[model samples]
Target: MSKIQPLNPERIAQMAAGEVIDSLGAALRELLENALDAQATRIQVEIWPSRWQVRVADNGQGIPASELEQVARRHTTSKLDGCSLGFRGEALHSLARLGSLTIQTRHADDAHGWLATYDRQGELAHQQPAATALGTVVTVADLFADWPLRRCSLPQTRPLLTLVQNAALAHPWVSWQVRQEGQLLLSLWPGQSLQDLLLQVLPQVDLSDLRYQRIQEGDSDWEVVLGLPDRLHRPRPDWIRVAVNGRFVQMPEWQRLIQSVFQHTLPRHRYPLVVVHLRLPPEQVDWNRHPAKSELYLQDPEIRQEQLRQHLHALLQSGSEQASRRSLHLIRASEAKSVYRVTSSPKSPDPAPSGQPSTPLPPLKALAQLYRTYILAEHPQGLWLVEQHLAHERVRYEYIQRHWQPVELQMPVMLEGLSSQAVEQLEQLGLEPEPFGPNTYLMRRLPLALWSEDPEEVQGSLRELSRCADLEAAQVAVACRGALRNGIPLTLEQMQQLLEAWQRTANPHTCPHGRPVYLALAEKDLARYFRRRWGICDRPISDPKLGSWWELEPLGDRFAAQVRRSSSASAPDPKDETRSAPL
Candidate 1:
């Protein structure tokens, strides 16, 4: 007996519908593509309160009465030219199987519109004379109701709204309106600019601070509009939009290009807002990679990515400089494809100019301490408020990473008669022990951080040493133990030394555990908190205690000079004089 069998036609249709209409977004995308292919100048979408009913209407060339019923069948499409948005006639067939689908359409010369409904078998179940304008309107209600698994697994509202937004962004020339549960979510008139669309996309940014850059290379065009370079986002920014040939797409290659461009400019914890739109010939892209068409295939994507990177890099560099037009290349008739590059004007990028005291730590003027925990200080680039303990921890961790030493155990003497394997492992880890009596081995030394560990912890760590995966695990453990603890009081002189030490570490932003060491506020930020006489900011205060805020101010350096003169007692830093920092 043969086990293989053909699936029932209705079952096949239902399964195919699941593939094409997996989510509400995918269903809307197919309808949207059809509307765009129709050259619709106006489109409207409506969703019911339960999100089970959706209607998409478009004003464009509609189906003729004779072929209206055939549109429900699979592979029945008029776009044999390969230039249209959607060609495989699976969407309507899928919709028919997924739910009850109704389409109302009429041509311009027709007397009136006709309504047709499709059954689950990809057949026209009903048809009748209807009233409507010269266009098409498709309404699909109770979507995926027959396929309960698909309905239960998929989201309706968010996907539908996101799909509509992308469609609106791609077809900026089309007037569009979207409503959910009888309330309007988005309404846009035709002829709105890309910048106008982006304003709604990134509502947090000021409109004026957004910068736009355009590049035209032969038949392809690229536009990258973004916020100011200093605008920092903590998470991967969802506002970044990418459109290729008038269709918004999510491509990893393009995403990589955008992200890599800002890698050097921004810290690891931050991202920038970039809206990129590229227009190429229709033949250069294929949108059939995924069921929803979110993935895109580009012609020579690497070349496009490199070209886009150079253009964006030049834009950022130029913004850093005044809008001087010094970096952008003007291609002449003979050299039209010359690549553009941005180079520093003085060759060596701006000199760390004099007049500012030359030091790793920018000279800072101390302000009043905040709540006896944070130290407030002013520098040229910004006003800095530093957490007292974390700042010292950052400095000490860097020092420990550079300077290693052996620790004497404070616990019981090393175990006697340990297995040779344990002894070998401990020796391999640099914790050498020697036998003083019969099978009595004593711990000579261990990593300083582990010296004070309970005997059980030491034994456990040694037992697990071979299983430790990370090479930095040992370094991090030692550094964490060696770092300064919180609640330790610091005089003004000790605080200054700690701040200077903090500035010298390679990565002063974060400690070994990746927590921030300090919070930096700009001069304008300080002004926002404290009202001051703007004109007198540069002048020395008449009160002996308050010095000029803008100038390099001192924090008890004079008092420290006096203390050094009077007594031989050194500053408060633990092991400060013993170990010099790495050069």
Candidate 2:
């Protein structure tokens, strides 16, 4: 066997450090993530032009002075022994190659500290005694100094501040401070909650329509804070943020869930602003699977998406009801359509003729329920599904949710003793159930479908709408309860009528949530399944006796018995063309 050759520590360090600075921000984020994993409650990051320095000092137990040199070197870490959760030597070794890096630490058990530094070439530049407090301080500067193009591309002080600011908001428990050219840009105290942190950074936020929620499913936990439907910052919901295990990432599947919830509420081209954080077990999610880690590998992305959609839809229905009551004077286009001219024409006879009255079915042809999601009715040759409650409430609430219109439909409705902020958020989301006389609003009008239903339940549904967000998130709050009452029976006539109306309605295939209303099985597919010729006769031969036939004898030359079978034994013809004269 050939002798083994050892890797030069200097060469390995330089190469790794180069790679780290190449993906500078991402690499820094990884280190910061490690700090968080370490249970650090406070983190401070600083920048020096092309030179970048990050200091993460935590109250957690510090490393002993004796091991400080080893920790600063390549492939050394204290976090790895407990759980196989983070990097081994990759993070530190990378940092060392890009610049002059150093680590200083002191422990409560040890009175002294040690300092070690690595130069740009990955060689150990120095090791010395140092004075330090009872914690760890890691500093790295001159990032990418050896690579001009990469160094030039590094963000200036201000942009870096923004990056740090965003990260700070994500972890509310960590007090954060930022400085550029000695000018303090962001200095924030510990936040009581995510909302509290948001208020601190985005002071101008219109919380009047905000909603927040926390949902747990098995090993996954999600926190969602959303704005009301109409109050979305853009025509469509654009402001959406997804965080997995506290690391902000772009998750397209998650976006689908939010879009499904906002389908009809906002106008085209507009998007909603949402911030959602998901805490999933690290093993279940493969962060290392990708170079950027922005994209995630979810074991059940579809299921997770559906869950999010359901949660949002429920909120929309509840919010609409409350808003409709408050703005009783408003009128929506849908409410106007409710006053349709009852056609008197006898029209076509019942198509099915199964004693089901030839009801006035809409141009729609089919209705499909996806895991019992928003009902989807066919959109002409296509499919359309309506959010039973959102569509109903939109029409009802739009009329009632007006600011200056007269109470033409919904009367002021009673609301439970909701908090003041919740009431404001409701109105912002277009819920304005007016106060009838203290705590109650005059129950006047409702979504046309809800007219015959219980006003008490409608009110209660709106009250319990967004269980996730503050009751202030009007649309989200009311959407859940406002949805089709689970298991409520509908008459065939009612079902038919609702289906018809939905088929002609805009966005027939989706309710307010972007969930599909129905999936169409094309005509060609039906023919293929039946193995029938396309638009041609070659009809199956039914009666051999009726058609001309020649008799054949057996091999023995004996005369064969001519047994004529009836054509009736063949498959039945779809078309009763027998009534037509023989061609």
Candidate 3:
């Protein structure tokens, strides 16, 4: 048998390219991450589509002339001591194998920088002097030039271009640019807030009702901003972004939690848009779970997912409740009868009408509140009995339930003395709070009334809410009670207005507390009750029907003929399931 010599560097490089990095974009992302980890203040990326060249220049710390060879070698990194999430061994090797890799660097202490180029032999092809700077610049040319199979498998330019745009949107705080044939296709400015970036990129998006959120779980914290009802757009499933420890991840559970909250509230096709920032202790998460670093593994993932969901639900509930309360207040204030004094305007009224004294009249009739609940009013349409408490509660509940953008609070509110049981339970309910004080906590902002106003009340409510395993139901209950108990009286005009408002609300039949508001007696049902129509007229009644006196007749005997005919007409088939079940 002939002895086999080791494969040549060209063969090794080709094999490495195919085996290591999955795609050109993923390979580029790895390099970018390294630059970011190096504390680069600004990074500039240039792409030459015609020449198949990609270059990334960063003002980060550079490799010295002496260390140039080692830096270009495979499986080498200065940033990791094996404790970091993305300290993998194959990034540099894979890039070097697939393309012509060149690196130019300047050390802070030296005036001159070193430049090195690596060829297919796994050795430095050339090393020379370079320009003066205290940073590193890497350029890759002829990507996948040696590997026809890998190059052929790569996606076309359009999807690749979209990828670049998405990356820029994900990191608005970092300045970035993507150029094709030396022409800029994507450019992002630094210091831009996420919302600003969203508005700038998604011009059609309405962000007027955006709000902020934060949730703390021991050392872990979550922050986010969500869009309001009018701001929310349909069909875009990925309107939400979740980041752990300032690094973004594409966690499926995050979407599920928020989607579950809005599933019943939003229409069948509508999706809630949100941007969430999660910060957990570095040790608690493994960010290298995927090549893109968009997927992560939390040590206690179930707890984390639940925490995120509850926090979002809380923010949503709070915001809706607050809006409902405000609207109710406005309606109450508007209902207060205003008294006008007759002065110079009275001179005009005196000529218009004859009065014993020129006195302005009060309301035509005083509206009565029956049983401290119903409002009896005479409208132009007809007499209306408005269930005051239930109507107001329904109005408040729907307004609170309306979708809105998320708002972040300047200060985090942390609740204290929470039983360990409650804390554990809260996580299951998705209420993760960040530490703010000795024992108090700051919550990720949710809609105002979705969460309890008092922290002490929240602990119990959360526990109960979780027990039923139905948070939305619990939220409705709480909101309804608060709304109905306000005891805001309504005038006749306001009562009429309440009907208009209720018509605009969702599920107007039930109060926020899950109680019925009104019962409309239809003409048919009312007539049936009086044995006038659609009634069981066969029953013997002393009252006469249609001016005819009721004759004495055996009720059962008279109904026998009708019952026999009905039974015969609707007789069940012998082969039916009910008949076939048993003898």
Candidates in order, TM-scores: namely 0.55, 0.50, 0.51
Q: Estimate, for each residue in 240-265, the C-alpha lDDT of model 1 and write its tens digit.
A: 67988767788776777787777756
Candidate 3 residues lying further than 4 Å off, grouped into runs, are: 1-16, 81-85, 153-172, 192-203, 287-294, 318-583
Which of the two candidates, 2 or 3, achieves a greater lDDT against the reference? 3
What lDDT tens digits, residue by residue, belong to model 2 across residues 1-583? 9989988967666655555446456555655666666566776665555455555555545667566555556667666443333555567667776656777766778877767777644446677778886666777676666767775565655546555555665778888776554566777788756666666666656555667777787887877777676654564443577777666777776787777678766645678877777777666676655544556677777777777777676666655334431122222322232323223331211113232212232354334544443455543333333445544432222222222232334445666676666566555434455675565543344433233256677667555541325322333234334545534555544555545444333333333333333334334433444436535443233356754223321321122222223344565675722221111
- The residue ranges of model 2 lying beyond 4 angstroms of the native Cα positions read 1-16, 50-60, 81-85, 120-124, 157-159, 234-238, 318-583
Worst 10 residues of 2 by lDDT: 555-564
Which regions of candidate 1 are displaced past 4 Å? 6-8, 49-51, 153-156, 232-234, 320-583
lDDT of 2 at 159: 45
Report per-prediction Cα RMSD to one decimal.
24.3, 20.1, 24.8
Best model number under lDDT: 1
Clashing pairs in 1: none
The global Cα lDDT (0 to 1) of model 3 is: 0.59
lDDT of 3 by residue, 218-309 (tens): 88766666766433546877676666654556778777777787775654577887777766667777765665567777898888777777
C-alpha lDDT of candidate 2 relative to the true structure: 0.55
Please say which candidate is ahead in TM-score: 2 or 3: 3
